[model samples]
Target: MVWEYEVRYQCLRERDKAYTNWLNRIPHKQYALAFDGGYRWGHMTTNLVECINSVLKGARNLSITALVKLHASQLASGNIQVSCFDRQNEVFKVREMPSGLEFAVDLRGLRCDCVEFQVDRIPYRHVFACCASQQLDWQVYVHDVYKMDQVRQVYRARFRSLGNPTTWPAYNGPWFVPNSYLTRVTKGRPKMTRLLNEMDTRMLRRPRHCRLCGVEGHSHNRCRQSAGANADRDAQ
Candidate 1:
């Protein structure tokens, strides 16, 4: 019964007709139900394991030892807190965003919205999300996701330039390059010097002035007037 549940629940695709027929043959009398799960969801049983899956989703291809190391790294990574920008408040809050999934961090708890946070004490993606969000080095995070062995081969391939760069694999459709810095200069464009001269420098770099306190040295947050105002409120 456990084997059947593992197969039906965990396996990638359920297209095999023989596997489906075999599941039907398992008699209830032959097996003792050990686990107590309340009312199973019909068809696919994903909700039952979503939390676990989220924890393992990023490093699904890793070996058993690698998985254990990944878990340990996750636990340790949680303590390393960073600042998160609150756009609405226009201030930086001292909070930890998970690695890799920093873009999806919950403003309230500073936690990743992924399921790993619920099941395990820490989500592995937090490590990657935090690094990416803060623009910190993410090589270690990538290493964790695609194990060292896989990364080694990838690095070797890149070093050798083994595969054909142009006219290579088709991804079925055009893939959008995310977080790319490359910009293309089309033909018949204005000269670079002319374009730079046409720009309004004032709009590009705002004056170092604080609207809240009428200051020059610092922004509103760090201004002496703002600090004095807050202190006055606390005293009252």
Candidate 2:
């Protein structure tokens, strides 16, 4: 597969100089599966990274100290919620809806028709209802990752207070230097927003052109030039 991609890339480079330059600008090792040690552990794209960035977008503007406090508070509150949920003895009933949709939950098997229990590893509305009906412990259905123990473990490490910079130990290592050639000058105000990719564009449909005649509306196999050539061969 890597060899095929390299061949196709070479063909593209031979055909288009601009495309070749654009391809060269990208790190092929990261994007190409043919490259050695390019495995991404089932993560083919940056969707996870983008999701995390979006989740922390608001926190990005906060001061480092404030952000740390916010995170600690959130973890503390989450642990409290988990503890409260664990102590709950809420009862549920399997009530039939007008729409004829009845949810059956099995706490023993940890399965629910709603599928939320399986996917989220947490008890869904139906599971809660079932647990209430059977008077079973619903907390057991919740995944361990969301338990109070796990939440506490996540925030177990305490942040140490940063002392005065003047009191810090002096570095005896080699002095650091910056390369003037690598430094970039700001021509204008930096863009704070992310640019949309081709997938995000409204104009998605591209006109197909005939590869043989270099014309629209037909492909190489159905081109007039190819038909004419076939006719000439038949005549010969």
Question: Evaluated with TM-score, which candidate comes out highest?
Answer: 2
What value does the lDDT take at residue 44 in candidate 1? 24
TM-score versus the correct structure, for each prediction = 0.21, 0.26
Clashing residue pairs in candidate 2 (N, C-alpha, C atoms within 3 angstroms): 92-132
lDDT of 2 by residue, 1-236 (tens): 46677788989989988887988898877667556364662354345456655556668778999888877765544221101122244322233342345444555566655677788998866766565545667788888998889999988999898799999899899998999889998876776454333323343466678988899867889898999999999999
lDDT of 1 by residue, 1-236 (tens): 35665565445236666755665577633432313232333112344455566677767787999999999888866654545666443223234434532334443343444545444433355544455566655453232434667667765753545477686786698787765456565656555321111123443575688879676756788788889999999999
What stretches of model 2 exceed 4 Å from their correct place? Answer: 1-96, 156-236
lDDT score, candidate 2, position 223: 90
TM-score of decoy 1: 0.21
Runs of candidate 1 with Cα error greater than 4 angstroms are 1-38, 41-45, 80-236
TM-score, prediction 2? 0.26
